[model samples]
Every structure is written in C-alpha cells, then in structure tokens.
Target: MIEALAPVFAGPLDFARHWLELAEAPEPLPRRPIALSTLLEEEVQRPLMARHEARYPGGDRRAALSMWTQYYCAQYLLSHLGAWLLLGRMLPFRPDDIAVLVLEDGTPDGFRLPHLGAVAEGPVDLEPLIREHLAPLFQSLQRHHRIAPRVLWTNAAVRVSAALNLARQQPDVPPLRLLEAEALLAKPCWRDGSPNPLHGTQSRVEVEGEMVLRRRVCCLRYMLPGIAGCGATCPIKEGQSAKPLPLLKSA
Candidate 1:
C-alpha cells in the first residue's frame, strides 16, 4: 500500500528537501527516521511549548495554549508523516487510513451514551484531511498569539465567492478584498535565512499577444505585533520589496 501511494505523495519529498535545505543540512540526507523524530520532539515541540509558556504566563489561557500546541504538533506530525512516506518507511498502516478513535459510551469498564455515533472517518485526500483536523490546532495557535487565520483566495472563483460571502456575515471580521488591495507580492524565501537560488525568477505569460511578466510568489504566516490576527508577509523580491497583501486574495 505504501508503495502504491508513493506517486500520490511525491510532493512530500520536495517539501522535505526544501526544509532540509533551509535547515542548512547536507544532501543525500540521513537515513535514521528516529533521529528526525527526536529532532522534532526536542527542537520543535519542546521549544514551542516553552515559547507558549513565556508568552502566556500562569496558564490562564488554557484553551488558547491547547490550540497552539495542537497546531504545531499537527504540522510536525504531518511533515514527519510526509517525509516517512517519501522515505518508504515500512509501517503497518498508512497514516491517513487510521481512523480516529472516539469513545461512544464508556466508563472504566464500559458505559453507553445514547446519542453518539462511531469514530470520525478520515478524508480520502490526505492533505485536506490533515488541514481540516488540524484547523482547531492552528486556531489555538492564533488565539495564543492574538491572531486569526486569513481566508486565502485561490484562482478558483467559486471558492473565492464563497469565502467572500462568508466573510460578509461576520461584521467584526474584515471584508473580502483583492490580494492586490494589500499591494502584496509573494516571493520565496528560505526560512532559515539562507539564500534561495530561485529568488526573483520571472515567468512570462502571454495575454492578448502581449507578454506579461509575473514572478512566483510564496505566502507564509507569522506573528506580528499590532496585528489582530496572524500577519502574513508576502515577500516579493526578498526583503527588497516588503508589501502587505490580503491574506485571502486570489493566488
């Protein structure tokens, strides 16, 4: 099954490779999966918790803390799972195939709740499944940092319209606006401050027999002060052009 699904998740390898390069590690990669797990556990998870504690002292915001922890953990888990899948790690079952266990009716031995169903089924699409399940976790992270997820718009018009309509219902929430409204340009950046060779690469698209130049954009979220929600920095041309773009503008 793992071998069969390899083609479906070929992108994971690229994702892992990008992260590895950002971390400034050598090529060929390490074969020990346990070492990667330990690295995440110690470096990622532990430090994230410490940061959370430092940000919110005395644990008053337990719910927010839980959400942040879940968000970071879910990201770490999904990334590792992706890397594992790419590495052809022999596992008893595919990560997405495993059903989440839900206790219906139970006591120490057993009990019954009259109005409950079976465990929630996992999504057929692993990426979306991971994203949806981890939504609450990400929300928690945002809450702790006093940030909210920006509803991003893709090229898909239907999704954009739906998102716009939804945003209208929440008065407190910001209104739907074009990505251009923020005057943001997405530019790829190495997370670890390393230079990316592909930086500022331009692609030309012919529209009406006229060639229009547009550079590739990479959007990412981070916490910033005075921002109600998590701030998205759409880096265009590296730090040379820092622009604020709508979080949910068309991509």
Candidate 2:
C-alpha cells in the first residue's frame, strides 16, 4: 500500500530508480503498532510532566502538562491521521490499521511527536476512526490530566483544524481527494469568519490563492509564555462570543 502511495508522497520514490537499488531495498521500513493509551502515557504525558517540572521549577506543573498534552495530541492526530482526515474519502482505512511511529524521544512536543506512520491494507470507516482511535486518545488524555471532557473536546477541535491546515502545507503529499475539505470549505460558515458549526473548530478554509483556516476557539498557546505569538483570531485578548454562535444554518 505504502509503495503505491510512494508515487504521491515521496518525490524520490515517485521517480524511476536504478534497477540494482530497487532490487536491494525492496521492502519498506518496519512499523510497530502501539495502543493509543500506551502511546499517551509513555510518550506524551510522562515526558511533558517531567520536562515542565524541570524547566519551569514551579507553578501548576500538572496543569501546564495537561495543557501541553491537549496541544500535542492534536498534532499527533494531524500528522498520523492525515491519511484518514485528508485522504480517507479516497484511500479508505481503519483505526486498527493505524500505528504511531515508535520514536527514541519520550516527549509530545512538536519536535518529538510520534507521527501516524503507517496503515495496513484494508477498508476504512470514519465512525470507527473517531470511536476507536480519536475518542480513546482523548479519553486517555482527560483521564491522565483529570481535566473535563468539555475542555479537552473544545481544545481538540483546534488541534484537528490545525492538522487539516498543516496537511495543506505540502499540498496532496498523500494523494488525498480532500472531498471533505471541499465540502466543508464550501459551507456558508466562514463567509463571515466564524467557527459556528465547529467541525474541528474550522470556520473557514480557502482553496485557491493562499489557503487559510480561521479557528473559532483559541488553543491557549498564548498562556504558555515564549512559544509563538497568539494569532489575531485568538480569543484570549478581547474575549470571543462563540457562546451564542453568531449564526447557524448559514453554518
């Protein structure tokens, strides 16, 4: 399956390689699947908690860790699940088929993310993808952090949107049809620039000339000092009125 996708995703693989080299390296790299819960505990939460304690010295290390996990997990979903989110409309897959990239680093920060590296040959189901994979990943996060599901879900919408936006960074690297994106983008939601319908907190996605996403909720990336500046759309500064959703149906 991956070899088939190599033409779309890998530029070098897309090329005709020398016969000798192709013969020598016939198989792709190996991948080991780990449960989402195990990945969260071992890779994300533990390392972030420890690192936050050492770096910040004090001040709600647990809370900081929790916040960072919300931020990080969304990326994991984005990077690994790009195939599902962006391309699933065409190349079908399932949660069980998904695997997190086993990495030497034991952290969930941007640099050390466990990419969604591989999927086995199989049929795909969107509902199960949410049920088996996304839901469990979030459940593990809330369980570990003792945070409310509302907060996790709210923040999760942002992360999901970020993943969608990020996938466009390399424009169809995985041979995605983006039927979902096209349908979502065509909705009346983003015309006024509001994230009302809250499909991944994405109020808007522009297709031609400067593809962009306008998020409804802030990721709270601002609260954690010295990351990157908060986006202009961030609700942190002046407060946002996503409460009574500016409009619906137009959504």
Candidate 3:
C-alpha cells in the first residue's frame, strides 16, 4: 500500500514517513489494532490506560491522558499535516479508515491507513481533517476523561505548527503551498465559521541564533509524576501552573 503513496511521501514530506503506515499486510504489525473511534469506550480505554499507567505508576489520570494526547497528535499530525502542506493531498484521515497501533506499553506507535486517500489538484483546506478527524476524537477523549477540548486541540496545533515550521525551512517546497500553510494559521474560523481551535496554538520565537516554537497552551505533562514538561516551548511560566480540566465543551 505504501507504493501507492510513494509520490506523497517523496521529497521533504518523507520526514513524517514513520508517523503513518501503509502496509501491504497486517500480519507484520508490531502492536495490536484499535479502531481510533473505539477509544471512546470505557472498556477499550480502561485496559489501554492500565498499560499506560503501568509504564509510569502514580501518574494522575488526567495528566496521563494529556500525555497520551501529545504523543498521538505529534506522531499522527506530522504525517497528516506534512502531506497537506507539502503536496496538495489528503491522506486517509477519517477515523473510520484509520487504526491506532498500540504498543505493549499502550502508547500509540502510529496510524495505519487503508490507502493514500487522494491528492487534490489544487489547494486543499484543513476543514476535512479538523471536522472529520480531530473534532470527533477530541470529543471522545473529553467525554471519557473530562479534559478540555482545547488541550487536545492545542496538542494537535503544536504538531501542525511544527509541520509548518518544517515546511517553511524546506528549500524545495512550492510557493503556493507555503501560502496555503500561512492561510491555515491565519484563518480564525473553519469553513462553517466556527472558531478554529488551532488558530493560535503556537508561534515562532527567536532563541539564540535560531527560531524555535513556543506553545500557547501547556499539554499538562507537568502534572505527571517524574515527567518533564515541554521546557522552552511550554506556555506555563514559573510558579503559575494548574491541572487541566474541561473549561469548555468540545466543538
């Protein structure tokens, strides 16, 4: 199946090559398959959380979920956003068409796409990826754990911002695609005019001689026992941190 996506993964987009899998057979997968949508179920989430908590005993449940969101968004969105920004393409990002591969420790390893969905002939907006994919997933996580939707959106946005940063640094990226990437960050609303959760989740700041990302929302990783926070990129400042709770409903 990966052969069908050779063109999409070509050039600078190959940086996200490991974030998604287009396998010819399922027999070789290193982890068990869990439908991304099924993550909403308590029965499914319980054991997954067990394996995850086992890895870091005594971590706060909400913090553990937040940490998981960071890992998931970073890995999955790299491939999704990379393809969108670099190639005018949309991968099989619909939750129904993808599966999360869970490692023995219950961290999501990567996504399995049924196939490379399609490539647009011209510009492609982010509505489909957001409304069709992230929104539902965020809703599920929010309903399950009562964490704010913004936390997950911000987690996802950090990855999108990172992908944009990479795209900007690429020497071979198309000029029009760069414009599209800028437009994505600039747009304050989705196609339906709803507030875009990703609009301002990250920004570039000069640190030393190089530009680095600063996140707008902390991932609550600091709440976990012994887990290091995001360090320089974290929005939280000294002596002012709080645990994440659902402040607003999921969009």
Candidate 4:
C-alpha cells in the first residue's frame, strides 16, 4: 500500500528537496524544525550580515541582522508547517487565515481569525475550522511572545477586493491576472525599494534625486508571460533578453 502511494507522495518529496536545497547545509536535513531554525540563523542569516558589513562599511548591521533573523524565524516556522501539512498532520491552526501580531517590543503577539474546526471525509467548513484550530495557535503565540500586537493576515481580502474593483474597470481581465500584476509590483517595492515598472501598467516616471531602481522581474514573467499581459514585449521574449533578471543591483 505504501508503494502504491509512493507516486502520490512524490509531490511532498519534491517540495522537501527544493526546500532542502535552499537550506543548503547538511545540519538541517530530515526536516526537523528546531534544527532548521538554528541552521538558518547560523548559515543564512549570520552570513548575510557578515557580507553586508563587509560590502557596505557603515549603517547598523546589528539592527538589520536582528530584523532579518526575526523574519527568517517566522519563515522557518511557516515552512515547517507546510512540511507537516504535506505529511498529513492536522495543524493546530491555519497560518494563512490568522494574522501575525507584532508588539512594540518586536515580538509576535498572536493571530486572529474566524473560528475553525476539523472536517471529516465530506464537505469542509473553513470558517469554523479556523476558529477552533487556528485561534488557539494565535492565543499561544500571544501568550508566549512569539507574536506582537500588530496583526498581519495572510488573506488579503481588502487588497483583493480593491484589485477586483480595478480589474472590473478594465474589460476582460481575470482575477488571477490582476493578482499576478499586483504581486510583481509590490514585491520589489517592499524588498529592495522601488516597484518593478514592468509590473505596473502605468507609464514610467523619472523621479529626481535619490531615485532607486531595483530591476526585478516577477516569477510570472518567467512562467506565464502570456497570462502576464506583456504580449510580444514580455520579459521572457526569446533570444538574449529572455534571461532572468537579477533580484538586486548596487546603485
């Protein structure tokens, strides 16, 4: 029976492989969350700071390192949750539905969402499931100082609604299309500062003084150029220019 299910389990194995590659160190293998966290801190996070300090002589490397460590920790927890989901373990909460609350002291407070419940082999009710399972996780985070007071929900209903409205104004635009476009615009803006102009349908402007242009292309640009609405001018257009763009470049 396990052999019969091997094909079905291949997807999880593949995902695990990809994650392990990103982790890169021998220490974090076999998917242990605590071990992965430690490896990430030592291998990835610490190295990032050391490189940053070496390259850019000034600025608070310590503060940047601290922030990145917190972010990486959150990401590690989320990745562990994903691995557990792949293994069929029922999670105590849904990280997506709940928001990450950040306190003034830079700790995570808790999460908030509609109630949740475990469903049997029939139809599922997501609302109650979120309340029962996810809420407790949020409460635990709050109690443990793993989260802060400010909440950051994974579901972007408000942003999605706004996007839908914008899409409605334009004829023949799909919801997925709008989302891809928005993500492309938002990612670089948050990560390295300045939105990737290619994602924005609007015309580009040359801002005076201290203008930073971080040349980044969205994944959709590589995977689904046709859906991205770039037409012949798609970033993935064949020949020399089709090559993927780098995420960062120094001014």
How do the predictions measure up, each by TM-score? 0.25, 0.50, 0.82, 0.24
Candidate order, TM-score descending: 3, 2, 1, 4
lDDT by residue for model 1 over 40-127, one digit each (tens)? 2334334444444444323223333433433333333333333222222222222222222111110011111112122222212223
Instruction: Give candidate 1's TM-score.
Output: 0.25
Clashes of each: 10, 2, 0, 19
lDDT of 1 at 144: 42
Off by over 4 Å in 3: 1-16, 203-212, 238-251
Please give the range of 10 consecutive residues that has the lowest summed lDDT in model 1.
Answer: 102-111
lDDT of 3 by residue, 1-251 (tens): 25554554566666545556764555445677677878767788878877786655555677788788878887777777777766667888777788887888889877877777787888777677777887888887788778888778888887777777777776777888777766666789877788888888788877677777787777777766556667667777631344332232222
The sequence of per-residue lDDT tens digits that candidate 4 reaches over residues 1-251 is 12311321243233322222122223322223222222223343344345433332333333233233334334323332222222222223444433333323333323222232232343222232323433344344344333331221221112222333434454444444445434533443423454432233332223455333222221132322111222332223431144433333234
lDDT of 1: 0.29
Whole-structure CA lDDT of model 2: 0.43
Residue pairs with clashing backbones, model 1 = 68-141, 105-111, 106-111, 147-229, 147-230, 148-229, 152-248, 153-248, 186-217, 187-235
RMSD of each candidate? 19.0, 11.9, 6.3, 15.1
Best by TM-score: 3
Model 4 global lDDT (CA atoms, 0 to 1) = 0.31
**Runs off by more than 4 Å, candidate 2:** 1-35, 39-48, 58-63, 84-106, 109-124, 166-176, 181-215, 238-251
Order the numbered candidates by lDDT, best leading: 3, 2, 4, 1
Model 2, 1-251: lDDT tens per residue? 23432333333222312110111233333322333445556455566456543432232444455455564555444434454544443232233443343333323322221232345444443333444555676667667666555445556556555555555566553433344443343343444555323355545545356545554555544333333423444545532222321221211
